[model samples]
Target: MNNELTFVSWNVNGLRACVTKGFLDHFHSYDADFFCLQEIKLQEGQIELDLGPEYKLFWNYAQKKGYSGTAIFTKHEPISVHYGIEDNEEPEGRIITLEYESFFLITVYTPNSKRDLSRLDYRLEWEQRFASYVTELKSKKAVIICGDLNVAHLDIDVKNAKSNIGNSGFTAEERACMSALQKQGFVDSFRHLYPELEDRFTWWSFMAKVRERNIGWRIDYFLVSEQLQNHIIEATIEDHVMGSDHCPVTLKLAIDVS
Candidate 1:
């Protein structure tokens, strides 16, 4: 059996819409061991996916209709499944955690600060709670966190970092939160693997053909515990895969789930 495991994360924007745009084609092609998704923008019973018999699906749907949500499709059965953050009510249904023998895999669709930064305060508060929850989990076992984090963590993470400074996703406060998370023994898998790679991004604007110009932001990420750093084999941005505003980001690790 293959010892390596493959994982894929994407912000589908809207599951129903993405399906019509070839979501299944890309899904089948990747054949990832764990496929996590964010911004599903749908409630329970809203849609159904035929991902074959090998995958088990877990979803956390937002209370509000057609809004923020998350899901995980995994080939391996998890020891436990959790939704939201430790019993605190998450009306947005932004997080889902699957516990395996060696690690806890969490997929989160972080709240955006919005264009006017009106939600910036709330977003920061949410960040604190999220960080604390993950830190607690890390104390027990290694963790693999993946999804659209909503913030570009570094200057190199955005196409026009200087020009975008102070913008919602590129603000100093949001960036600091991401830095703090990394300081707590987590490694951004892609950046760790390709520190100097540029012009590579995951999310792009629909305006003025920004995506075609490669003017995008690396807000989606796969953050693994520092202990798993050496296990990372490959990390890539699947920019060519088209289904939503954000393309898929993939990670291949040398570790075995079995």
Candidate 2:
């Protein structure tokens, strides 16, 4: 069996809408071992996807219709699958945890701070809870965390950084939360692999055709436990694959998923 495995995470904006925009084309082209998604904006029986039996599909839906949601399609069936962090009950369907032999895979669509920063306080609380939850998981086994973390950790993560300072995604508090997580025991896979690469972004605004100009933010990410750092081979952003406002971010690891 191949020792290396590729994983892909994308915030499809809305899976149903994205499918009309060529989601399946990109999904088949990548053929990753695990394909995780967020902002799926779906509920039960909303749509049917036939990815074939080789893959196991899991979905977490928000109680509200067409709102925050997530899903994971994996070729390997995990020992167990969990929705939400223990006892936290994230009813928005924002987190999915899968347990495998050597590691745990978690996909999260973190709550976004509203444009006016009205939700900033709630977002901060979530950041702490999520970081602590992942840390706890890391204590048991290596953890791979991915999806729209919704923060730009460094100035390099967003275009026109100077102008965007203190904005929702680039706020000092939000950035610090991400930094603290890395300082603990997790590594941002993309940044760790290409420390100085520039003009690399994941999410772009639909406003003003800015995506054509490559003006965007690298808010989506794949983070790995410190112990799994060396297992990373390629951490990449599929910026050209356009089916949503945010593109796919991939992590190629030298470790097996099962």
Kindly report which residue pairs in candidate 2 clash with one another: none
Global lDDT of each candidate: 0.94, 0.93
Q: What is the lDDT for 251 in model 2?
A: 95
For residues 49-103, what per-residue lDDT tens digits would candidate 1 score against the true structure?
A: 9999999999999989989999999999999999999686899999999998788
Candidate 2 lDDT over residue span 14-60, tens digit each: 99999999998898888989999999999999999988778999999
lDDT value, residue 48 of candidate 1: 82
Measured by lDDT, the strongest candidate is 1
Candidate 1 lDDT at 138 equals 96
Estimate the lDDT of model 2: 0.93
Single out the weakest 10-residue window by summed lDDT for candidate 2: 81-90
